[model samples]
Target: MPRTRVHNLNISLDGYAAGEYVTLDAPIGDAGRLFAGFDGRFIHGIDKADAPVTLDRVLTSTWAQGIGAEIMGRRKFGPQTGDWPDDGWRGWWGDEPPFLTPVFVMTHHPRPPIEFANGTSFHFVGGAPREVLGLAQEAAGDLDVRLGGGPSTIRQFLDADLVDVMHLVIKPVTLGRGVSLWEGLSGVEDRFTVETIASPSGLTHQLWNRNVPA
Candidate 1:
């Protein structure tokens, strides 16, 4: 069975995943420091060809590995909200999106699918988490579906108990007010078996695997 996975989801010590206000100039907004130690070049994963062997690189490499399709929130797709403008905004990645697979953007407003030559296509979808996941899984075929998110979207699927695996990088700072990753879903960790690994970069990486019933 193809699994649903989330990787490199950086959250603050205060439980915030991303900033509240995301603009075109500041993609991550005030939460830019959360990814201060991240190397954008290693998003495609590390194979000893580019970056040195490190815990971060090793883990980041798994982001694109075996991921046939991705599901992201509208905010993760762009900074626009309510209704999409006619500015012809493709995404933050321009022509070549880092994701080589089909990406399903969760949105209430629908638009035509955007295709790219680099194998990254954006399909706007409107539905419940499970329904969207089914679409991604269908597109994924024999591979796994990646829940690439902006917290709110991740929370929805998590609330539905549809996520099979998740990788959270916890930073040691507090945003105080922002898009929180855990809200209302108290004790959500009880559903998963967590393994913790602290790195020298002061980031705690938590790998969460959904518990299997006996």
Candidate 2:
């Protein structure tokens, strides 16, 4: 069976996944420090060896591992709201997106699927978590479905108890104002057994997995 999972989601000590004032210029807001572990060389089609060998590198390198499909909120897809500005706007990613698998973007206003040359397609849909998950699972087939999010989307799946595994990277920073990952949900930890690993780079990796049913 294909499982729903979240990987390499970075959050601050203050519980903010992303900072304030998110725009096209600042997609992640003032939380640029959250991605300090990422190597710019890999993002620019440069030599992979130029990237640093750190725990972040190891985890980020496996972001798309075995992921057949992805589901993300509209915010993560872009800074657009209400109706799309233009049909020409595919997404923040260029012609070749990192996610080669099919991606479903959650939105109230659905649109025709956008196909890219690199085997990546964006399908906009409006529905509950289970409905969307069903669509993604059908597309994923035997592989896993990843919940790529901007906090709120992940929260919906978490609230619906649809996520099988979650990998969070807790950075040592604080954004006093922003969308929080753990708001309005209390006792969420009770559902999953968490394993924490401290990295030399001062970030902590936390893995949460639901208990297997006998």
Candidate 3:
């Protein structure tokens, strides 16, 4: 069975995921940019046939083998107002997006279906978190659905207890400002348990698996 997972999500030492002021140019904001690093190496590592052979192996491995579909927030998808003007804008990743599978984007605005190169397709859904996750699960088949976060989106799923697994990369830097990851996470510690903590490249990567009792 496939699980819903969040991967390579970076947070500052102060628990902020992104810095203040997010625009089309700075998607992740200031703090998040440093924590996530400018390089798209994480996605690049997955594009290869052979398994990743470096510090990014863990992330790359999950992306390559387990990913079947992707769910992202509107902000994570692109900077657009209302309905999409045209199909000219595929995504921030250009023609060859890192994801080659079906992608479900959460948005209030409606737009026609977007089909891109490879096997990527963007479907817009305007509904609750559970509804979107259900659709993503159906599309995922036997592979896990990747929860592409934009802070608020991640929090919504987390609040609903829909997230099965989360891999958080705690960057060494301190973002004194911006969106804080722990703002609404009042009960996360009681619900999720830390499974592993790896220190690769001086970055602390923490893995948490849902502890929902059957």
Candidate 4:
């Protein structure tokens, strides 16, 4: 069966997934201070030689594994808002997006699909989490649907109990104020079988799998 999954989501010690003042210049905010320990391959598009074999690298390496389609919030797509001033704003990924499958961008103002040179195609839509998940699942076919997020979007799916598995990387630093991942999610751990692995880079990787009936 196809499942919904969140992979390689980095959160700070203060529970914030991304910092404030998001703009085209700094998508993740704080100049990406939270992702200091992440691999260069993710940030700078560096060669594999520069990336170490740490847990962060190892986990991120499998980011595209079995993922056939992705669903992300509008902010995760780009900094543009209020009617998309220009259709040419492809995305933060440039010409060839890393996601080689169809991507659904959650937004109130839906736009026409943008097809890229690579296999990536961005489709904009606005609906409830469950509704969006259905579209993603249909697009994913037999493969899993990846929930690419920016905290708020992931929280919505978690609240709807639509996520089947999640791999959250807990960075050691704290953002005093920003978008939090666990604000209203009290006792969320009760629904999942939690496992943790500490990496050499001082970050802790946590896997949460939804408990299944025996």
> Which model scores highest in TM-score?
1
- What is the per-residue lDDT of model 4 for residues 1-214, given as tens digits with 9 covering 90 to 100? 9889998899988899987777988998773767775664642122356544555777776677788899999999988878888657988988878898999999999779999888899999899999999999999999999999989999999999998999999988877888999989998888999999998878899999999867
- Runs in model 1 deviating more than 4 A are none
Candidate 2 structure quality by residue, lDDT tens digits, 1-214: 7789998889999888877677889888788887775553342233367655666677666567678999999998888789887757888888988888899999998789999988899999899999999999999999999999989899999999998999999989887878899998788888999999998878899989977766
Candidate 2 lDDT trough over 10 residues, lowest sum: 38-47
Pairs of residues at least 3 apart in sequence or in different chains that clash in candidate 2: none
TM-score of 4: 0.93
**How high a TM-score does candidate 3 get?**
0.87
**Most lDDT-accurate candidate:** 1
- Candidate lDDT scores, in order, read 0.91, 0.85, 0.78, 0.86
How far does residue 142 in candidate 4 sit from its true spot (Å)? 0.2
In angstroms, how far off is 19's CA in candidate 3?
3.2
Candidate 2 segments exceeding 4 Å error: 40-52
lDDT of 3 by residue, 12-93 (tens): 7888776666667876656644555533555645545453456655464565457888999887788676777665777787
| Native-referenced Cα lDDT, model 2 | 0.85
What lDDT tens digits, residue by residue, belong to model 1 across residues 33-101?
Answer: 787877767767576365578888788888988899999999988999998899989999988899999
- Cα displacement (Å) at residue 41, model 4: 2.6
Task: Give per-model TM-scores.
Answer: 0.97, 0.92, 0.87, 0.93
1 against 4, candidate with superior lDDT: 1
Q: Give Cα distance to truth, residue 77, candidate 3, Å.
A: 1.1
